[model samples]
Target: MLDAPSSSPRLALVSEDPLARGALARALSDQAEAWTVVAAGTQEELEAARGEPPDVVLWDTGLRLEEGAAPDLGAPVLALVADEAAGELALGAGARGLLFRDVAPGMLGAALHAVARGLTVFEPGLSHVRAAPRSTAPSGAPGPDTLTPREREVLGLLAEGLSNKAIADRLAISEHTAKFHVNAVLAKLGVQRRTEAVVRAARMGLVTL
Candidate 1:
């Protein structure tokens, strides 16, 4: 289960551009007295925030998710992107919603509240991108895409920077089993490397970042 939010939700903001980061922080101050904003202008701060997990992570174009990481944060994150493609990347990283820089300040609070509830929030007139094509194939089709839920769970953990031993401990499995699942994920994606598997899976929308 996800962690419960404190009396007031904690907010974390990450932006490569300090001006943009500060602007967002100031705009969010009107949200709630319980809300606290933690500012991060680099990947280092982003990682640090993830360790303690903020209630919300407002991401601008500056942040990128590295390999061996699936977004498994305790707090929800809303991504700010410059365009549609950037939004897709944020979605792959488990962002709860995508917004452009021009969004009205009033919407930020509502968006944050919506995302905290696990729904995707966006501007009313923005276009929605479809990720997958409809398929008529049976449930057990003959291909690597038919991974079981357990396999998907393992794959997600692998993408989240967990070593084999670490994943084993988290899942209560043997290291060998965790390693086996990682290999399976690689083979399913038809990639020989962990990095490639993550990229391929995320692009295909088979696995979230």
Candidate 2:
């Protein structure tokens, strides 16, 4: 266990395999900024070590949902699964987010932050999994189904936490054009921030994280 400043959001990494848990913790620690990696172990050990609930719990489910049950970690849980079936199972088990085991460290960090803030996250691979029905879009706002193909592409990049320049490079378009598409996606989703748009898109089954 490592001590982190109280101001930094605390993340608990839970996995059944010690080797896998250590590797994930190290990766997360390497990219940590807004949050800190606190402990890696079972939920009970994490709670006992900190003597308080973490802001978020990143549970690495490996190839299966252990014992076919999601633990109540006394905090939001972001599940790291191996495949879409396990991802769906984790969601059904009440996990706030479902990411694949091969997720990049940066994307995993973003999902942890999002889930900690009470937003649901899904891996792009799980886009085919239909999410539960959500409330209709805001009045005068275009639904997710109405986003243009390019705008939808921008939305997916946003879900990956890409900046305007990064998106431009990825799409081989002008930065200004990428910015324009980002704004369009935000407006259509009726959200002001990239994270919000990602959340809305995921809930609408338009895009995943």
How high is each candidate's TM-score?
Answer: 0.53, 0.55
Highest-scoring model, TM-score: 2
**lDDT (0 to 1) per candidate:** 0.64, 0.75
How high a TM-score does candidate 2 get?
0.55
- Model 2 / residue 170 / CA error / Å: 52
lDDT of 2 by residue, 73-113 (tens): 57899988888777777776568888889899988888887
| Candidate 2: 10-residue stretch with minimal lDDT | 129-138
Candidate 1 versus the native: TM-score? 0.53
In candidate 1, position 99 carries an lDDT of 79
- RMSD (Å) of each candidate, 1 decimal: 11.4, 17.6
Native-vs-model 2 lDDT? Answer: 0.75
